[model samples]
Structure formats: structure tokens, C-alpha cells
Target: MKTTIFTFHPDLKNGSRINASLAKAASEASFEVRDVYRLYPDFKIDVTAEQTVLEASDRIVLQFPIYWYQTPALLKQWFDAVLEYGWAYGSTGNALRGKEVLLVASFGAGAEDYQLDGRFHTTVEEVLKPIATIQYHTGLLFLEPFITTGTLNLSDEGLNEQVEKYLNILSAE
Candidate 1:
């Protein structure tokens, strides 16, 4: 399957460790990796280009860090601009139908903090409900998410392990 990874970190090159490393690993594994933030630094997404890429890929991976329990601003914009009416939804919008979407998210807090009664008082699945709605609307198949928690203190060994796991997910058919 043809897999494309779209990374949405605001400052991946300078201010990120986990996301940067993950993107690098995916790229090295021969998967197409697009740094959305780098592609549209001013937030001016090329709707046609984005949609074209999506149409050509079988698996779409959205990689980002959970910020304030939300996706990065550019990703929200990408969804709005790329997944349009009569193209990705509505009666004639079956461009993404049957395509798989995987969300790879990293959290600064520990996994325990995302429990029902944890610090956030919510689960990661709850945080990603909006994407589920998108999947329903766009006819995209939502796969089990790949989550990495406690990024703030993840050791080098832990990050290496996470990269290996991420590659495994990307390589899976």
C-alpha cells in the first residue's frame, strides 16, 4: 500500500524531538513524508495539491503532537481546505472512501493523565472525536491510533523504541 505521512508540528526542525525523529524515520523507511508546516508556513495550503496527494495514497497518516488537547492549527486548515464538499463528502464526494487514516499523536503528559479520572479527566479517544466525525463524513476508514505519551521526559532509548514501533505501524499492510 502507498502510505503518505503528513506531519503538522509548528517548529519541527528546531523545537521538536519526538515528532522530528519520527518523521525522519518514516522518510528513511521510504514512505512519502510531507512536513505540512514547512510546506505551508504561512498557512496557505494548496488545496489541489493536497487533495491530489491524498487521492493517490492508500494510507494517510496524520502525525502531530497534541497541543492543548487539539490538533495543530494548520492541520485543521488542511482539513477545511483539502477535504471539500462534492470531493471528499456529499453525494459525489467519494475521493477518500475506503482509504485508511491513522493518527499518530504524541502527548507531553503521561498515559495515566488521559484516564477517565486522570489529570485531564479524559481519554485520548475523546480528544480525537472530531477526527472520528471527519472519518464518518468523508468515508475514510479510521484505524487504531498510534499514541506516544510523556514526550516531555521520554528518554533517548524510549524515543528509539517509539520510532521502531512507528515504523512497524507504517510498514504493516
Candidate 2:
């Protein structure tokens, strides 16, 4: 399958650790990795180009670090711009129909932090409900998210292992 990973890390090269490594692994594994911030430093997203890329993909992966329980700014902008009224939803919007979507997110908090009785008092699934709604409305299949919790304190070995697991996930059918 032609899988495309749309990574939305603002300071990807310098600030990020896990996501940067995952991006490299995805690229090496032949999954098309589009670094949105790198491409649109000015935040001027070209809707046509974005749509073209999405149109050619069998699977679309939205990879990012969770920020205040929401997606980063550019990703939101991409969604607003690229997923137009008559292209991604509405009666005539069928471009993304039948496409599979996966969310790969890294959380600084541990898994326990995102539970009913945990620190945040909310599950990750609850946090991701809006995206699931989008998938439902747009006719995209929402796959189970690939999440890495406690990212703030991952060891080198653990990080490498996660990278390998990501590669495996991307390679899976």
C-alpha cells in the first residue's frame, strides 16, 4: 500500500527526539513522510498539492506530539484547507472515501495519566473523539491509534525499539 505519513512537528530537526526518529524510520521504510511545517514555514498550505498527495495514498497517517490535548496548528490548518467542503465531506465530497487513517501520537504523560482514574482523568480514546468524528463524516476508516506514552523519559533503547515497532506497523497490511 502507498502509505503517507503527514508529520506536523514544528521544530522537527532540533526540538523533537521520538517523532524525528519515527519520521526517519518511516522514510527509510518507504512510507512517504511529509513534514508539514518544513514544507509550509509560512503556513500557506497549497490545497491542491495536499489533496494530490492524499489522493495517491492508500493509508494516511497523522503523526504528531499531543499538545494541550489537540493537534498542532499547521495540522489543523491543513485539515481546514485541504479537506474542502466538496472534496472530503458533504454530498459531493468523496475523495477520501474508503481511505484508511491512522493517528500516531506521542504523549509526554505516561499511559496511566490518560485514564478514567488517572492524572488527566480522561482516556486517550476520549481525547481523540473529534478525529474519529471527522473520519466518520469523511468516510475514512479510523484505525486504532499508534501511541507512545511517557515520551518525555524514553531511554535510547526504548526509543529505538519504538522506532522498530513503528516500522513494523507501517509495513503491515
Candidate 3:
């Protein structure tokens, strides 16, 4: 599949220990990764170019470090700007129909911290409901999301293992 990943980390250079590695692994594969912050530093989005990539892609991956349980500011702006009324949804919008949408997110909190009785008091799935809605409303196929939690304490070996699994997830049918 032709995959396009929209990576939304503003401090990628400083904070991409895990995500940056993943992006590197996918760099020459069947994927194209876009750094949203780098692309739109001025917050001026090119909706046409954005939509064009989305339309050409067979799979769409929104890769980011979940910020306060949501995407970073620039990606949010991209969504609001690119996913317009007559393109992504509404009467004449069918741009994303039959395509696939996925999210590959990294979280600072551990897995146990994202549950009903955990620190956040909600499952990661619960926190990700809005993205599910985007899939449902857009008539796109929703693949299982890739999530990495507790980034701070993972050893190099552990991190590489996770990256390997991530490659598998991307290659899986």
C-alpha cells in the first residue's frame, strides 16, 4: 500500500527518540512521512496539497506524541483546514471514502496509567474516540492503531523490539 504518515511533533528533533526511529524505519519503505511542524511553521496550511496527498494515499497514518490526549496544534490545524465541508465530508465530500486511517501515537504515561482506575482514569481507546469518529464519518476503513506508552524508561533493546513490531504492524494485511 502507498502509505502517507503525517507526523505531528513540534519538538521532533529534541523528543523523537522513539518516534524518530520509527519514522526512520519507515522512511524508505512503502511510506512517506511529513513533519507537520516543519511544513507549516507559520500555521499557514496548504489545503490543496494536503488533500492531494490524502487522496493519493492508500493508507493514512497520523503519527504523533499524544499531547494532553490529542494531536499537536499544527496537525489539528491541518485537519480543520484540509478536511473541508465539500471534500472530506458533507454533500459532495467523498475524498476519503474507501481509504484507510490509522494512528501511531507515543505516550509518556505507562500502559497501566491509561485505564479506568489508572492515572488518567480512562483507557487509551477511550481517549482516542474522536479519531474513531473521524473514520466512521469519513467512510474510511479503521485499522488497529499503534500505540507506545511509557517512553521514558524503555531500554534500547526494548525500544528496538517495539520498533520491529511496529514494522510488522505496518506490513500486515
Give per-residue CA lDDT, model 1, range 36-112, as digits (tens).
Answer: 99999999999999999999999999999999999999999998899999999999999999999999999999999
Residue 29 lDDT, candidate 2, scale 0-100: 77
Best by TM-score: 1
Q: Is candidate 1 or candidate 3 better by lDDT?
A: 1
Which digits, one per residue and each the tens of the lDDT, describe model 3 over residues 121-155? 98899877887888756788888889898987878
Index of the highest-lDDT prediction:
1
Count of backbone clashes, every candidate in sequence = 0, 0, 0
Residue 10 in model 1: lDDT: 96
* Root mean square deviation (Cα) for candidate 3: 1.2
lDDT ranking from best candidate downward = 1, 2, 3
Better of 2 and 3 by TM-score: 2
Alpha-carbon shift of residue 29 in model 1 (angstroms): 0.7
Q: 1-173, model 2: which lDDT tens digit per residue? A: 88999999999998779999999988987778999999999999999999999999999999998899888899889888999999999999999999999999989889999999999999899888887899877899988899999999999998999999889888999
